[model samples]
Target chain A: MIQAALTFAVTCFALALVFNLWHLARAPGVVDRILALDTMVINAIALLNLYGISQGTPVYFEVSMLIAMVGFVSTVAYCRFILRGNIIE
Target chain B: MLEDTTLIAEIVVSVLLVVAGVFGLVGSLGLVKLDDTMRRLHAPTKATTLGIGGVLIASMIYSAVFLDRLSFHELLITVFLFLTAPITANFIAKSYMHRHVDEGDLPPTEGPYGWAVYDAVPEDERPIDTK
Candidate 1:
C-alpha cells in the first residue's frame, strides 16, 4: 500500500514540477520567478521525502533539511536585493 | 507477514503521502495559474509548506514503524518550514510592493513615516508624484 502511494506521490511531484517550470519560464516579473523557484524547492523537498520512504532510508531527511535552509535563505536574499537594490545593504 | 499494526502503519503512511502530493501539486498549480504576483505569492508559502509537512509526517511514521526507532529529526523540517514560510511570504510581498506595486494598491501607512519600505529614504527624497 505504501509503495502504491509512493508511486502516486511521484506522479504528483512530476505534475508539480511541470507547473513550477511553466511559471519559471513565463513569469511576468523577477519576483514571480523567484516565487516559482521557491515553490520548486518545496516540491523538491517533498520528492526527496518520498524517495527516502520508498528506499527505507533515513539519510535523505537531512538532505531535505538542507534544501529547506537554502530555499528560505535564497528567497529572503532575492527579495532583499530586489527591495533594497542591494542584497548586502 | 505483515502484522495488523504494521498494516495500519502502512495505511497511515499511504494517506500522508497522497495528501502531501496533492497539496504540493495544488500549490504549484497556483503558481502557474494565478493571474498576478501577489496572488501567486499566496500559493507555495501556505499550501506547499503544508504539503511538505504531510510528507515529513509520513517519513516519521516510516522511521518509527519500519526502522524500529523513534525519530524526532523529521519534525525539525516541519518546525523550520513553519518558522520560515511566513517570513518568506512577508519578504516577497514587501519586495513586490517596493518594486512595482501601484501606490494605490498599498494600504495607508499607519504612522507619520511612510510605509516601512519608504522609511529608508528621507521624505524629501521621494518623488512628489509617488504618494
Candidate 2:
C-alpha cells in the first residue's frame, strides 16, 4: 500500500517537474524561470520524503533536508544577484 | 483488534495525498501558461503551499499509523518550505523590479513599502541606511 502511494506521488511530482522546466523554457525573464525552479525543488523534496518512507530508509530524509537548505541558500544568492547585479563583494 | 480502524485511517490519508498531487499538477500547468513573471508567481505559491500542505498531512497520517507515533519531520519540512518559498519569491520580484524597471522606469513607491527610498541609495549604503 505504501509503495503504491509513494509511486503515485513520485510520478505526479516528476511530471510536474517536467512541466515546470518546460514552463521555464517558455518564460522569457529570469525571474519567472527562477520561481518555477524553486517550485520544482519544493515538489521534489516532498516526493523525496514519500519515497524515503516507502523504502524504509531514513537517509532520504537527510537528503531532503540538505536539499531544502541548499535550495534556499541558492535562491537567496540568485535574488541578491538579481537585485544588486552581484551575489557577493 | 484495531486492524480495520487502521485501514480506514490509511484510506483517508491516501486520498489526501492524491488530492495534493493533483493540485501540484495544476499549479505546474499554470506556470507554463501564465503570461508574465508576476502572474506565474501566483501559480507555484498556491500549489506549493496548499498542494504540498496536503502531502504533509498525508505524511503525518502514515507515520502515525505505521510507526505508532506522530512523525513531525514532515511538519518541519512543510513549515520550512512555506517560510522560504515566499521570501525567495519576494526577493526575486524585488530583484526583477530593480534590474528590469530601471531607476527612472519605476513609478515612485510611496506608502509603507519605501521601495523607492531603498532604490534611491547606492547598494553599499542601503543596508546601513535601513537602521
Candidate 3:
C-alpha cells in the first residue's frame, strides 16, 4: 500500500519538475529563474523522501537534509548576486 | 502480522503523501502559468511551506509507527524550510524590484541610504561630497 503511494508521489513530483524546468527555460528575468530553481530544489526533496519510504532506508533522509541546506544557500547567493554586483561582495 | 490499527495508519500516511504531491504540483504549475514575477513568488512560497509540511509529517509518522524508531529529523527540515523560504522570498523580491521596477515606484529612503542603491555605499559610508 505504501509502495503504491510512493510511486504516485514520484510521478506527481516528476510532473512538477518538468513545470519548474519549463519555467526556468522561459523565465522573463533572472529572479523568475531563481524562483523556479528554488522550487525545483523543493520538489527534488519531496521526491527524495518518497524514495526513502519506498526503499525503507534511513540514508535518504540525510541526503534530503543536505539538499535542503544547499538549496537555501544557493537561493541566498543568487539573490545576493542580483542585489549586489558580485556574489562575494 | 499486520494489525488493523497499522492498516489505518498506513492509509493515513498514503493520504498525506498524495496531498503533498498535489500541492507541490499546483504550486509549480503556478510558476509556469503566472505572467508576472511578483505573482510567481506566491506560488513556491505556498508549495515549500505547506507541501513540504505534509510530506515531512507523513515521513515522521511512518518512521515512528512503522519503522518502530521515533524520528524527529523531518522536523529539522520543516523548521529550517519555514525560516528560510520567507527570507529567500524577500531577497528575491528586492532583487526583482531593484532590477525591474522604476526608482519612482520605490519607497522613500530612510536617510541617504537609498534602497535603490543597495550595492553602493551606505548613507554614512559614502565620502561626504563637500561641494
Candidate 4:
C-alpha cells in the first residue's frame, strides 16, 4: 500500500512540475512567471518529502526545510524588486 | 498484533500521501488555468501549502511507525511553511498591484494615507486630519 501510494504521489507531483514549467514558459506577465516559479519550488519540496518517506529516511527533511526557506526568501526578494525597482532599500 | 498495527499505519500514511498529491496537482492546475493574475495567485498559496503540510504529516507518521524513531523535524518545516506562505503571497500580490493595478481602481482606504505601496509621504510629515 505504501509503495503504491508513493508511486501515485510521485507521478502527480511530476505532472505538477510539468504544468508549472508550462506556465513559466508562456506566462502572460512577469508576475505570472514568478508565481509559476514559486509554485515549482513548492512542488519540488513536496517531491523531496515524498521521496524521503519512500526511502524511509529523515535526511530529506532538513533538505526540504532549507529549500522552503530559500524559496520563500527568493520569492519575497523578487516581489520586492518588482515593487521598488530594487531588492534592498 | 504487531502486523495489524503496521498495516493500519501504512494505510493511514498512504491515504495522507495520496491526498497531498491530489492537492498539489490541483494547485498547479489552478496556477495554469486561472485567467487573472490575482486569481492565479490564489491557487498555489492556499492549496500547495496544505499539500505540503499533508506530506510532512505523513512523513512524521511514516518515520514513527516504520523507522521506529519519533521525528519532530518535519513539524519545523510545516510551521515555517505556514508562516512564510502568507507573507510570500502578500509580497507577490503587492508586486502585482504595483505593476498592474492603478490607484484609481482601488477603493479608498479608511485611513487618511494612501496605500502603503503607493504612499509618498514620510511617516511624520503627512497631515493628521481625522476625517
Candidate 5:
C-alpha cells in the first residue's frame, strides 16, 4: 500500500512539474512566469520529501528546507525588483 | 497489536500522500488554466501550500511510526513555509499591481495614507540631500 501510494504521488508531482514548465514557457506576463517558477520550486520540495519518505531516510529534510528558504527569498527579490526597480535600497 | 498498528500507519501515510499529490496537481493545473493573472495568483499560494503541508505531516507520522524515531525537523519546514508563503504572495501581488494595475482602478483606502506602492512622501518629509 505504501509503495503504491509513493509511486502515485511521485507521478502526480512529476506531472505537476511538467505543467509548471508549460506555464513558464508560455506565460503571458513576467509575473506569471515568476509565479510558475515559484510553484515549480514548491513542487520540487514536495518531490524531495516524498522521495525521502519512500526511502525511509531523513536525509532530504535539510535539503528541502534550504530549497524552501532560497525559493522564497528569490521570489521576494524578483518581486521587489519589479516593484521598486531595485532589490536592495 | 504491532501488526495492526503498522497497517494503520501505512494506510494513514498513504492517504496523506495521495491527498498531497492531488492538491499539488490541481494547484499547478490552476496555474496553467486560469485566465487572469490575479486569479492565477490565487491557485499556488493556497493549494500548493496545503499540498506541501500534507507531505510534511505524512513524513512526520511515517518517521514516528515506522522508523521508530520522532522527527521534528519537518515541523520547522512547515512553520517556515507557513510564515513565508503569505509574504511571498504579498510581494508577488504588489509587484503585479505595480506593473499591471492602475491606481485609479482601486477603491480609495479612506485613510490619510495611500497605497504603499504608490504613496508619495510630502515635501517636508523628503530626505535632505547631502550631495
Candidate 6:
C-alpha cells in the first residue's frame, strides 16, 4: 500500500515537471515567470516528502520542512526586490 | 487487525498525493508558458497551491501509517504556503503596474484588465516594459 502511494506521488511529480516546463516555454513577463518558479519550489518540497516516505527515512521530512521554509523566504525576498527595485535599500 | 485498515488508508492517501503532483506540475507549466504576467499568475494560483497541498497530505499519511503516530507538520506548512504565494504574486504585479503607469511607460490601457496601478508610482522612476 505504501509503495503504491509512493509511486503515485512520483508520477505526480513528473507531471508537475512537465507543466512547469510548459509555463517556462509560454509565459510572458518576469512576474509570471517568477510565479511559476515559486510553484516549482513548492512542488519540489512536496516531492521531497514523498521521497522521505519511499525511503522510510525520517531525514527527508526535515529536508522537506527546510525546503518549504527556504522556498517561502526566497519568494518573499524576491517579491520585495521586484517591488522595491533593490534587495537592499 | 489495524494493519489492514492502515494499508487501505495508505493507498487512498497515495492516490491523493499523485493527483496533487499532477496539479502542481500543470500549474508550474501554466506559469511558465502563459504570456503576460497576469495570465501566468493564474497557473500557480490554481495548480501549485493545490498540488503541493496534495503532496503534503500524502506525506502526512505516510508518517501516520509507518510511524504509527499523528503528524501535522506538513499541514501547517501547506496552510502557510497557500496564504503566502498569492499575496506575493499580487504584490509583484501591483508594484510592476505602479512603476510603469506612473512614468507613462505603458499606456493606462496597455496592461491586461487595464491596470492603472502605475498611477501610484513616482513620476521619475516609473518603469516601462522595454521588452
What is every candidate's C-alpha DockQ against the true complex, given to 2 decimals? 0.88, 0.64, 0.75, 0.91, 0.89, 0.58
Candidate 3, position A66, lDDT: 98
Distance (Å) between predicted and true CA of A70, model 5? 0.5
Model 1 spans with C-alpha error above 4 angstroms: B121-131
| Residue range B1-131, candidate 2, lDDT tens digits | 59997888778777887788888888888888778777778888777667787887787787778777676777887788888878887887786777576666567667434465253555565556564
**How many residue pairs clash in each candidate at the backbone level?**
0, 0, 0, 0, 0, 13
Docking class of 5: high
Report the poorest 10 consecutive residues by lDDT, candidate 3 chain A. Answer: A1-10
Q: Per lDDT, what order, best first?
A: 5, 4, 1, 3, 2, 6
Superposed Cα deviation of residue B3, candidate 3 (Å): 2.4
Query: Chain A TM-score of each model, in the order shown?
Result: 0.96, 0.87, 0.93, 0.98, 0.98, 0.87
Report the C-alpha displacement of residue B100, candidate 6, in angstroms: 5.8
lDDT of 5 by residue, A27-46 (tens): 99999988999999999999
Q: Report the Cα lDDT for residue A70, model 6.
A: 82
Residue pairs in steric clash, candidate 4?
none
Docking band of candidate 3: medium
For candidate 6, the per-residue lDDT at B77 reads: 75
lDDT of each: 0.87, 0.77, 0.86, 0.91, 0.92, 0.70
- The CAPRI classification for model 4 reads as high
lDDT of 2 by residue, A1-89 (tens): 65576677777878888998887687787887788778888888878877766765556767887898888999889888766678886
Candidate 1 residue lDDT tens string, B58-126: 989988998897898789999999999999999988988887867777688875566777666566766
Error of 4 at A60 (Å): 0.9
Query: In model 1, which residue pairs have backbone atoms overlapping below 3 Å?
Result: none
lDDT of 3 by residue, B1-131 (tens): 56987998899999998888888888998888888899999998887568878888898889888989888888998898889889888988989888888877777878756664444665567688744
